[model samples]
Target: MSTADNNSQYDKFPEVAIAGRYHEAWQGWPQVVAALQEALAAQPRQKTVLVVECYHGVAQQELLKALILPLRPAALFDAADARRSTAEIEALIAGDLTDDPVFGRRSSLPLAAFFDPAKCAQMQQAIAAVSHGLVVVAGTGAALMADGDLLVYADLARWEIQQRFRRGELGNYGADNARADLLSRYKRAFFIDWRVLDRHKVPLLQRADFLLDTHQAGSPRLVSGAALHAGLRQVARQPFRVVPFFDPGVWGGQWMKHQFDLDPAAANYAWCFDCVPEENSLLMRFGDVRVEIPALDLVLLYPQPLLGDAAYARFGAEFPIRFDLLDTVGGQNLSLQVHPTLPYIRQQFGMAYTQDESYYLLAAEPDAGVCLGVKTGTRPDEMMAALAQAAQGEGRFDDARFINRFPARRHDHFLIPAGTVHCAGAGSVVLEISATPYLFTFKLWDWGRLGLDGRPRPLHLHHGGNVIDWQRDTDWVTRELVNRVEPVAAGPGWQEERTGLHPSQFIETRRHWFSVPVLHHTDGRVNVLNLIEGEEAVVESPSGSFAPFVVHFAETFIIPAAVGAYRIRPCGRSLGQRLGTLKAWVREEETPC
Candidate 1:
């Protein structure tokens, strides 16, 4: 789908190099199959039990085909056979996977909840009976079937799973709802499947004999667990990028297709999941192949070094900052929305915090602007009533009468603390920097447009009304949220400025422009940055701890807290040009609001 990405410097499949000593990863079905055979042969046992546990969304049938011919196991068991029936599993998670189009109650269900005790016991007995040759137990929850002499974990990225959802090729675990509403499937995965599966996979990352990447069909990469862990350790000590994924949306536009060299055949590119660790992937280079793994693995495995000691203590293995693009450059306006407040999210959604976002206008047309807050004197009750009427198709919401519009241009920053009514107008490509709890946004309006499903999108007027801050009117927004930049520090050929994310937001943003090398310190917290301007720049360590890394225009990169001191300077096409980068990090120290 993204064949053109190869020609683009964006490096759609960015890869981090593993040290040569730990580059034991084997590529392709031929090499991967041989490696598995060698490992099993080396095991000192008359009868060997090989458990190949897959993360949900992996191609189970394909994996079995790849192994059945080579290993010629005497017996095999699919963990799926041990799961509860489809109807039973559906009933089990119905409460957490609610009827809401885009939201679901957070689930506390563990992986074991999806398995039937009797079925699991039966599978174990079957495994115990196989006393000779190779006995293979493979599939999601395979480890529950039996403890194997050598266990391998096959992992797939969340973004790839989302693509499978769009393509109607995969469904929720133990559920047959692939053709159901796209949003509902995503809701289930986000609220239940991923949560439970992640709980199951975290512990396995440490002890699995091998890590398998089956991202490509008929081709897989296998890395010894020790080598994989060593590679992750290397990643935690340098600058790297999560493998980005782009998707088309109802409000998607053409800017990304042209700017990022995206698939021209796609309708439009709406979002680029730049540095969102939750769903993005990490690529480790081995020989000529790039093996994909979830970026969350790095955060969960090396939280102290990847997130820094302070951020690890606060977020607890959660990646607190997120960066993505909202492209409306040649499309319709985004739904007028407001994210829930912290207190409301905590009590209602079981999230630790809410999304406090800022829009850095990466690119905008001449007429681009944003709808922010309400008119200076607008009353909450009156606006709510009008929104209620609009929901019922009474008439238009008369946004001009109640919503304050601010002209947005390239490089403009708009701070959106939770509860502020805002949406980027048409013709703007937004770099949305926010806290990681991203789905709490409640859409109150959509310009009366139909969703891609040919129905009016669901409205959350009641939820929006409860959280809307009427006091965040035209005057307050003008004073506090619009391009609130202050000079911080400067050096020859470089200048640094603090950009407003609002004091209430825990993520702090900084903008830097330079024509020469500019020094930076991670300050013991992970740093996420986007090259918002110019062509390219190189990030280097002062003491050469890691190799110099190059970042291109609009690509986001991360500096693990352990990276310590680093420097970035204009390079390639921008060697003598002034380039700009927008940087964000968790604010460990508090300041007066």
Candidate 2:
């Protein structure tokens, strides 16, 4: 490139150098200073170099001394800094330095004003006017102009240099790496939970099970039931049992033993309650996702046909399968349960069921266990016999039938198909992705336990029995669990295979750790960007509109369809290094008749 081109690039804050203990600081600072000094010394009389400092600091002091003092003919300070306001800094640089009080204060400068680099515009234009003489140095002066040009000085630290780097100011630095690292650490720090959830204060749990029990009447009435049936009689006709499970005793026997921490008998860990009725079943609504099943205390994320009718109409039409990130804190050895397949549900209950799901294990303690498919050679009769014995409180069914068992480990993903008997082990936080609205869990065994209310937890033996496919193809279950495809390539976009039975209903998601600018093509499909790892990225539209997108851990963003091409740019000093991004595209599939 010619000198003019080079000068233009450098003038626009083409490079940022962060000068600290790290060697990377030399990237943007010293180079720009040297270039400016060379140009100024060569054409001194004709061109006036204006160095504006916003305020006084160590870095600013050093910068002025090194670059301006060597060839200084004039000096200026921001008149605004002094209690005396004067003419604008612009007019003074135009050989009008003595026109007003602005010109007098411009002579005594500090370094702090430049702390905010955005204010360097006016100073740059004023200096450019001096064609060859009187290099004016002012505190709190503009170093950059509107036309994308910049002025540089020495004695600035690496952090300031890096800031200018993002504005297209610095050069020759591994800015992408620094930016990525900085962004990553910020995200990690921001997402760590510092406070634990107190059960008494949890709003959703309180709303689900508030009861008005009368000692005189002998039974309690769930307040939620009254709210549902008050005026919307037709809509709220379904009955529900809103039972809360905040006690440790109930969870210890049912699901806690398999988790990391042994149930603290004194501490109430499991705060969920079942919203079931004494006589009839009711629809349970939590947030957006709702289910029309027997009222059960289950943790849900984004609910299917999202919470309200309006939200359902808006999002359900485009994104149907809702998912939640479930964190099962204590070990849970749930009663052996089986979900009915679509065919079985349709044939037996005249209902459609799609229970295919996968678990992305996030955390697990030693001895963390999960019960997968039934034993390879075990038949329906053997399972039934074992279940009968267990129901009668006879033998330990877990060890007798040789049911498929495995220790849960972090990052391990297990795919559970409908009718494949399975249970979530204790001490695990799993990201459960499924294609079912119904949580139809048929309990085959529950370790003979009762709730705090002195009632034995009812088991759905018949429903569970009818759904267990005795002659299930074991190979299909194993294959789905073992097979997983990498979603993102090292370069761009994602590569995912059609592995699951309903692969068409699932989207291909790619995880990305981007540093430099990446332009992605959306191809007319709606995309969801979920930030599982990091924060702050600039999603710039093809039309040049850009917004700062912040992603805390587990936060999600739904990018509208027809978004076209977009570029992601990291923010702050850790622009490229610590920044992480995930891209997801909705999979198109024909609705089942």
TM-score, per-candidate, Cα-based: 0.96, 0.43
Cα lDDT of model 2 by residue, 200-234, tens digit: 11223223212111111111122222332221222
Candidate 2 Cα deviation (angstroms), residue 527: 4.8
- Residue pairs in candidate 1 whose N, alpha carbon or C atoms collide under 3 angstroms: none
**lDDT tens digits, residue span 30-92, model 1:** 888888899999988889999899999998788877765578999989999989999898899
Q: By summed lDDT, which 10 consecutive residues of candidate 1 come out lowest?
A: 1-10
Query: Which residue segments of model 2 deviate by more than 4 Å?
Result: 1-319, 347-353, 452-454, 470-476, 492-530, 534-547, 556-586, 590-593
Deviation (Å) of 259 in candidate 1:
1.4
Q: How accurate is candidate 1 locally (lDDT)?
A: 0.89
